[model samples]
Target: MESVITGLILLLVLLVFISEIYKIRFERKNESQDERGQFLIFKVKSLSYTILSAGIFIGFALVAILKVMKPEIFIYYMIIVYLFQSVASSIYLSIVRKI
Candidate 1:
């Protein structure tokens, strides 16, 4: 089970890397140099901010309601959220361009 999780994570990482490379190429062509590209960047950041804010809300709720012990788990939770946001936005941007 752990191996499967590891494999999936590795696959996701590889996909994100490829997507970033494509994003770079696309940008180099000046495809995203205009308002549309700026809009896409705005959209990606908006989505990322939404995710980040949700994470913050959840963290606060968990702390207030559950009174979480140690308080260190929040660090891990935040790391996961930010990492997910990065990858998810990257993928979203790439997919939007293709569409």
Candidate 2:
């Protein structure tokens, strides 16, 4: 029962998160950019690249220290990390561009 309740709560949160993302994308669909927007885009891209490189390095270090030789787990971890960083970078750029 507890597990079921937890799953339900997690599902609810996921739904809410997805809805919010959809709303943001919908709102920005027609938005146009200028020179400032171009600069912001460049900065965000650079920052994201740096973060991704650092994250990959840290992930490698973690796997080495833990002696996790499973290629599947390492691949999954890298995918998750990349997705997380991408989402975070997108959200940050959206907010900063709006402001």
Candidate 3:
């Protein structure tokens, strides 16, 4: 029951984020730089975003695996894993921008 509720909340949050990104993209489409530059930047940014997303997926998998054996430590493990992943993502984005 708790997990279901959490899942629903997460879904709602993701939907909101997607909507906001789309709105921002539309708003900047004409005012922003040339189409080519926009495309290149967005592509590079998305690459970093994909890597970070993969890390999050791995974190969730680890959480599920540990849940079966050490339920008590699952939450702590998830938090630490996600925190590190977030840091890694920021680093990746910086590197991507340079490349």
1-82 per-residue lDDT for model 1 (tens digits): 9999789767766766775676676667766789888788788879889998998788877776778734777876676676
Report RMSD for candidate 1: 2.9
Regarding lDDT, does 1 or 2 come out ahead? 1
Worst lDDT 10-window in candidate 3: 85-94
Colliding pairs, model 1: none
**What residue pairs are clashing in model 2?**
none
* Residue 49 CA displacement from its true place in model 2, Å: 1.0
For candidate 2, give the lDDT: 0.66
Separate clash counts for every candidate: 0, 0, 0
Report lDDT (Cα) of residue 49, candidate 3. 64
Q: Which stretches of candidate 3 lie over 4 Å from their true place?
A: 1-68
TM, every model: 0.70, 0.60, 0.39
lDDT per model vs. reference: 0.76, 0.66, 0.55
Residue-level lDDT tens digits of model 3 in 45-75:
5755676577557656666764443557656
- Candidate 2 steric clashes: 0
